[model samples]
Target: MANHDQVLDASGLNCPLPILRAKKALSAMESGKILRIIATDPGSVKDFDSFAKQTGNPLLESGEEGGKFFFLIQKA
Candidate 1:
């Protein structure tokens, strides 16, 4: 996995909140930077996948640990 430049905690947030915060975080970052996001929403699997696809950002890694979802996304 790439070294993340920022971390966004979306844990306990549902649906678009995670994706929305991620978008805001990425907006403030330089292109090609990586953001690590921690979310509790099970729907985040599909949400992050679609978010990356729609935004053209590369989803580097994503998995669950301790009932939480972890995602590494490189800003487009």
Candidate 2:
């Protein structure tokens, strides 16, 4: 929740969309900037985790709140 550099609300979006949108958002950010992603798809938890590892980005924090899955990804 700390002043994210960008916010991507992928709620109600399925599989690849959430990850794809996240990638686009992260691509637009400077290194070390954070992208706050709010997704409804449960697959995003694992998808984003793998994405961070594969892309060399960092998953700072991830959790759920009020039926929404949230991820804080830092561009690296």
Candidate 3:
């Protein structure tokens, strides 16, 4: 079983890897929980934004820091 909150580090991974990992993580989480994802792929920004919109999961936050893209997704 996964914890209520989790952080997934996907830095250095390319497209689809980060999103795929996020999807898997979200699948393991309960409703209302949050998942933090760290990705280095530039495409992840747009991919995750669209994923969140399409999946109906709330995107709590998205930004870049220390040359990495970070996303906080709340499971609905």
Model 3 segments more than 4 A misplaced:
1-4
TM-score of each: 0.94, 0.95, 0.92
Which one wins on lDDT? 2
Can you tell me which runs of candidate 1 are displaced by over 4 Å? none
Taking all chains together, the TM-score of candidate 2 against the true structure is 0.95
User: What is the descending TM-score order?
Assistant: 2, 1, 3
**Model 2 Cα lDDT, one tens digit per residue, 1-76:** 5668889999999989999999998888999999999999999999999999999999999999998999999999
Estimate, for each residue in 1-76, the C-alpha lDDT of model 1 and write its tens digit: 5589999999989988999999999999999899999999999999899999989999999998788999999988
Pairs that clash in candidate 3: none
Residue 43 shift from truth in candidate 3, angstroms: 0.4
lDDT of each: 0.93, 0.93, 0.90
RMSD of 1: 1.0
Alpha carbon RMSD to native, model 3: 3.9
RMSD (Cα, Å) for all candidates, in order, is 1.0, 0.9, 3.9
